[model samples]
Target chain A: MNKRILFAVIITVILCGLAQAKTTITWWQFWTDPNIKPVIEKMVTEFEQANPDIDIQLTDLTWANGHEKIVIAFGSKTGPDIVELGSDWIAEFAANNLLMDMSTQVASDSADYEGWGMATYDGKVFARPWILGTRVLFANRDLLTQAGYKENFIPLTFEQLNEATKKIQALSPSIYGWGSNAPEKHRLYKKFLPFFWSHGAKLFSDDGSMCLLASDSSIKALKVYKELHDSCGFVADQRGIEDAFLEGKIGFIISGDWLLKRIELENRKINLLSSFIPGTKLLGKSFQGGEFLAVNTASKHPREAMRFIQFITSPENQVKFCVANRSANPSSLEAQKDDYFSSSIHLQTFIRQIKFANHPPVDPDWVYIEQAIEEAVENALFRSGLVAHSLYEARKKIEKIKAQ
Target chain B: MKWSKAGALALALPWLLTFGIFWLFPIIYSFIIGFTDQQLLAADTQWVGFDNYRALLSDPDFLKSLKNTFIFVLGTIPLTTVIALGMALLIDKQFPGRGLFRSGFFLPSITSMVVIALIFTNLYQRGGYIALLSEMIGLSPPEHGFLYSGETALFSIMAMDVWMAVGYYMLIFLAGLKSIPRELYESAEINGAGKIRQFFSITLPLLKPVALFILVVNSIKSFQVFVEIFVMTKGKFETSTMVYFIYETGLTTKFEFGYASAAAYVLFVIIGVFALAQFLLFRRKQVAW
Candidate 1:
């Protein structure tokens, strides 16, 4: 009887031990795509199999409210162990000391990711770059052909683009020449930055102290934007521009790679083509932006979070995630050489444009500065305000924000 | 056993505690925060003591938002009240398909605001249904879209709001109409009074309280409009209402908690003053009548 009791007690102890051995890592991510969720779930399952003692608890956040949720979670000191942050959000979270310093973990291959600049703050790596994205010019080939353009013709210079837009406009009264984004605060800067960069304009000084929006280059860029608006007119927003292009109502548009994937999924046959943005003297550049994975400073299991980040950012995994999304480029330089990217002409153009892609300044106060730039662009384009004067006003506003 | 004070207190304790914790504490805390310089991401806060409020007074964006909100309120309330009253009158009569008409009108109010805003956004596009209809009717539509043009964007949103809100207010008016004595209309008709005269003499006077209630409620709602602006134009094209500005300041852009709190308090005061003024105006009119 005593031997039987001992055996039962030992079995109970072993069961409790097994239950207590596993540690749960709460992961909050913002990938809302139904297709991407299964991919991430499979990855999590693989990671759990590899690390038997760790379990991942995944929570999906909506893109519309994800940033606000993260802010609130960190403010209340109840954030998850791991979070998927936008590249631009790293500086804000790091400045608040809410993100763990992943400097040592990321030190080895930090140079391999082009988007590392956005994930670094104060010379310290706080996040692991996962995806890379850049926008390129997309043209409606049917509209171009209707406007008397040659087959497969792509505009490579600002002058040619301008002339092509006019021809497209003259083709039909209902059609527009260019599909451009309206002055939306969150995305307007992204739409305008390429033009600003191509005209040799700098957003800030080397040390990021002074605003250079009123510079001659910036004014020149604004004038070019104004000219485009006068000729083609701006769409209500990015989605409006995409819809206009999809409907064959617009000849030219600059958009992210997501549109290409969307066209493929919908089986849209509008003779759409992609190319680098038009430039005057140099190759057109666009915004380099993406998502990163970061460890919350308040996490109980920082090491496990770091492991998960590493697992997700591994070259093979990165390629898998990017391929599943069908829009984002892999942050891994090795993954960029994958056959999937090489086989597609659409992906090839984006890869080439990514070479000239530039990221916005990784400052905590960049949101305010971006608003100032958006306001300046809006005033120049819609209000018919003088470009130099609008830029000068924006400079004053940005200086005030910087002073604060 | 008869309830005693202590017994009542015990029963009310749960609700009172919830109210105190969830409602009262946040209000007081936010009010206190309004007097300080607090960034949500900053580690430390300083007691700035009305500096943020002072800044808002001189801030152009705040002023514009205030103006826009006032315009929205003025633009929506009267139209919504009149149309709601008209709809209530039309539906109150016994007619065939009355129930269907009533439900059809109320459908928009029952539908999700986000969905309605999105649908309206599409309709306001350059070649969307509204624009196409306008062009067919020999009216020149805006070159871009209704939402793309600064001149018409706010008005377009106001029109949609009125359409969406009239139904709910019409239901309220219907309730008010139901409470009135039908015999008064019968007596007036027997005295040779026309339908218009009876409506003006009996219906309008009796519905005074309901009208006041609708006016005050609609005004407050119009001033607090945010979701439509958020989903439709995102406060672009001069559609930045006061609430949208506060949302942008507090949540979206800089997370300037202190300044946003100050702005919010200012909006609260404006709403309170308006409500009080409306009550006084209507009460006096009622007493005189």
Candidate 2:
């Protein structure tokens, strides 16, 4: 009887503690490793220190499982207070009303966010950009020099890049000319989009109500991709594109600044020159992607949550997060001015070039469309030779989806 | 008196309620959702009748997924069974390092599926270790690692799955082996019957039930192969099984829950037919035994 009475008292005290505790905003992130969590936690800690009335609990998930879990959580209305969403996911979430409108918050002058306009949906920005990443050329200067190309004289146009790759291929049979991903990364769209832009094709017209992919401009983009692949004289196996680049088999590689994080570790001694993929001068474009930090609208403490997002996205914290984690070019204009740019001239070049980048449209179905386009293009270029038909078919599929 | 029916039902009540609310309700509701023509959120949804299912039957990707899923089940089951049976037979006898061998065989199963998939992706990588090994051994290594080519991607993933899952099913087979009433094997030995004959005559008849159980489970798992595809290929590699297509269509691309729900029912029917066949075949065998 005495023990039972003591146990009851202990349980009552625990319950009281739980009820009286500070409200914790549960946060979930797709980045699940020490590589990203430390800076995020430090930012959270500072916020918690500033606001003693609130607590932020963090959960981590791998990118593979991340989206599915978030969707399930959102469907069940058991979602976390905050979630880091990809640029494309914001459209679907906002369209479904699964995410809250932040335009009012921004209008209220309560939230100072730093994300690209792509994450905006119906005048409401759903995400705040954390890292600025875009696909560009990473040239192995040693390989280029051996092939008798000038060290700093990278191509300024797709035509020049082809000629340059031909020279590199002639230098060595064992080492390839250039490397890009297999069709599987669905990255063909990234490789091809700049060309599409240069050819005067818009994915959707000004109003986002029509498909321009089947247009002559898009066909011209297809021809450009075919020329690049064939003249590059190489293809990295699917998802193996990064590995191929890292193994030093290619003279030039087309991949992202995010990949540079992994690439620099391997070829620290091998001089790498990063340059913008020179367009055909009709339009200079790059496909921009980045992580974003946003306050959860459903959070019990939206004001506090907004404060945390602002603090983390601040220029000082951005530098800390970027440098500490070897992050891609920081999203903030101010953080791009840091000392890290001295050696990584390529990443700096991306920063200079990002001002000209029109982010790949934030259609909710972009990932799927990209995939179908990639497969169609790959089939047309590598397997069969139906470039025009492939573009048309892929665009038709996207149209059907958008129509629904 | 020890554990009353009322107490047992009370203990199970919470689980029943949970399944009823979260699992059963969602599944039933989804089947109903599949019949709707429009997006459930914001958009007006209406009865589409057989449109969703009809659309699935006509969709080339759905047909491709169905084919891939069947191919995956066919490829993995026999391979897993043979390997599992061999392991069960080998470990049934006491040998040096037998405990260590058993643990080593089971180790891959215990590693998180994502980790296992990553390790295999490297192993099966172009110019990776396996390629290097094959070249050294005077074998014709694939130009690129298997998954790069559409012909071998699904097979490559299926092979990795069999390697990971064989040990788990071997343990099941080992359990069945133990229950074979050792006297039967001893009698065959006394009659001077050879080991192979004894295996076919005595061991197989008894192991029929276990074999059917493993095959049915392997089919279901292989049909729903997602984690491996999710991690290694991300459904690239021609490895988009039914579950993977359902996953990407529902979540990765657009949230076309109606179409995805219909696809799930299609996969459900595929599995249902296979399960029924297994039940019929095994029921007769069980009676004969």
Candidate 3:
């Protein structure tokens, strides 16, 4: 009886000591919407349950002020162990050495994920890709049918799409053909660069020392865009354009998966059809954007933080998260092949388009470089026969930025 | 009652601490940052002396923003002041539903600027209400609507600013009108002055101080135009103001803290000069009167 009691007391003491050794890691994430926050919470709970020695403290951030908050947190050296960063933001932080070098950690598993190019700096991976998304063309079937086209006809080429849009627009004075982007910063380039890429234009030289925006292919792309803008396109910011498309006043709009989910949830009466972005010969390439997870350099528990990231970014967990997000897709190829995407035609179209999508150049200066590209597009759109001049000016500006 | 030095310092401690921490600290720190190449996330900050200031003088974007801010200040202040004066004059007299008119006119002023700007954004969209009205009136609106065109974007924002700001300034003018001792107007009437003559001589002279206040305050506010542009256009279509430029530089696109701080200091000096000029001009006018 004495030996048994002593054994029981030792077991209790060891359990208590193990409980006291639990490590708590703080994670700041941007999935705060009612429908999505629960998925994250559930994942964290599962992670904690599976690894009883580590606890996660989750903080919610809004899209509007999240960037500012992250910057301030890092500035004060109080950054969370794990933080979610937009794809475009990873380069800037990595360039500043604010993120931990994760190339060795993720080397063996890097081939399993997409969007590694965006998270890499100096050929080193700094963040892990989480969710990936691409854009597709949303067409109004009724508008096409009303304009004497077949009910389910899809435009596989730019010329055909433009012609059909013009005819649809001619049906009524209130109707518009293509929903083009206005000169809104951070948005117009996203709409224009696909065409630039479709025409085989490279944004920068192979050495990354010079901008190639003034190339013949780029000029041709701009000319094509201007022709579309003048023929039947209506200009507005992204929100206005989406609204018009939903209201049945626009024939076609190139938008992301969010619009597909929006139409499915809110207004199902509209006969919507999705298709790939039309190219000259083949389908045009779309822009790839995504969210990534990074470990802060100042983190006290880098191992726990990376383990949590890997746990949350596993194929099953990613598929679950994207299913709840309703618009985004998993960055893992295995998750992309899941039954959910294969079953839904609209989601399938986005998945297929991701195969042909291209990410922007991975550079620390891309933020300023994108602004220059946006200004060039806007300048070209505002004036006729100035596409070349605008591109030339943009090249000069980018060179100046690089010099600075 | 007499108080000890310790008691006095204790009473002033809270406000002094707040001022030192929030206002004075940032002002001085930003001033120092303006002289160096201080990037937000970069570890190394080097003193560049007057390079930032020199670059601002030649930067086309800064020059464009300066010009736009000036145009905004010049275009809106006079119009807002005159319209507020007119509305105040009309409502100062006993009229039906005077209280209702006052509240209705002041509603936009009290409403959140972001909400107002968003409402205006939809109103300014293509085929929106404003476009429909333009079409109905047999006028050709810009093909892309008001906010999309470079020629009309700033003007559209300025028009909205005037509409929202008129009510507040009108309230101030009403207070000034009320404080003018009505007997002065009666005396002018007794001297055979008509209503318009009395307004030009007695009311205008008495309201000079209020007018000066409105002009200075409106100039400062207009020069720092950012929220409307940020919400409605995001500094596109030539609508970027000085503050907006600084914000985009330091916070949004690039974290060029040094350049943005330099731009902000220039704006501060410009505002100071303008306010001083206004004070001097009003003093001269007051002496002449």
Measured by lDDT, the strongest candidate is 3
Evaluation by DockQ, superior candidate among 1 and 2: 1
Q: Write the per-residue lDDT of candidate 2 for residues B1-289, one digit (tens) a residue.
A: 5989999999999999999999999999899989975443334578888899999989988888888888989888999999999999999999899999998998888899999888888887667787789889997665556666676778878888999999999999999999888888888999999999999998888999999999899888888899998877777656778998888777655467888999999889989999899888888856233
Candidate 1, residues A56-94, lDDT tens digits: the string is: 999999987898898888887889999999888889899
TM-score of decoy 3: 0.95
The digit string of per-residue lDDT tens for model 3 on A30-95 reads 988777899999999999999998999999999877988898788668889999998878888888
Q: For each of the candidates, what fraction of the native contacts does it recover?
A: 0.59, 0.26, 0.59
CAPRI quality of model 1: medium
TM of each candidate vs. truth: 0.92, 0.79, 0.95
Candidate 1 regions exceeding 4 Å error are A1-20, B87-104, B174-202, B287-289
Candidate 3 wrong stretches, greater than 4 Å? A1-19, A383-385, B287-289
What's the CA error at residue A34 for candidate 1, in Å?
3.0
User: Candidate 2, overall lDDT?
Assistant: 0.76
Error of 1 at A169 (Å): 1.9
Task: List the candidates ranked by DockQ, beginning with the highest.
Answer: 3, 1, 2
DockQ agreement of candidate 2 with the native complex: 0.21
Backbone clashes in each candidate structure, one number apiece?
Answer: 0, 1, 0
Which candidate number has the best DockQ?
Answer: 3
Arrange candidates by TM-score, highest first: which order?
3, 1, 2
In order, candidate lDDTs are: 0.88, 0.76, 0.89
Candidate 3: Cα lDDT at B101: 97
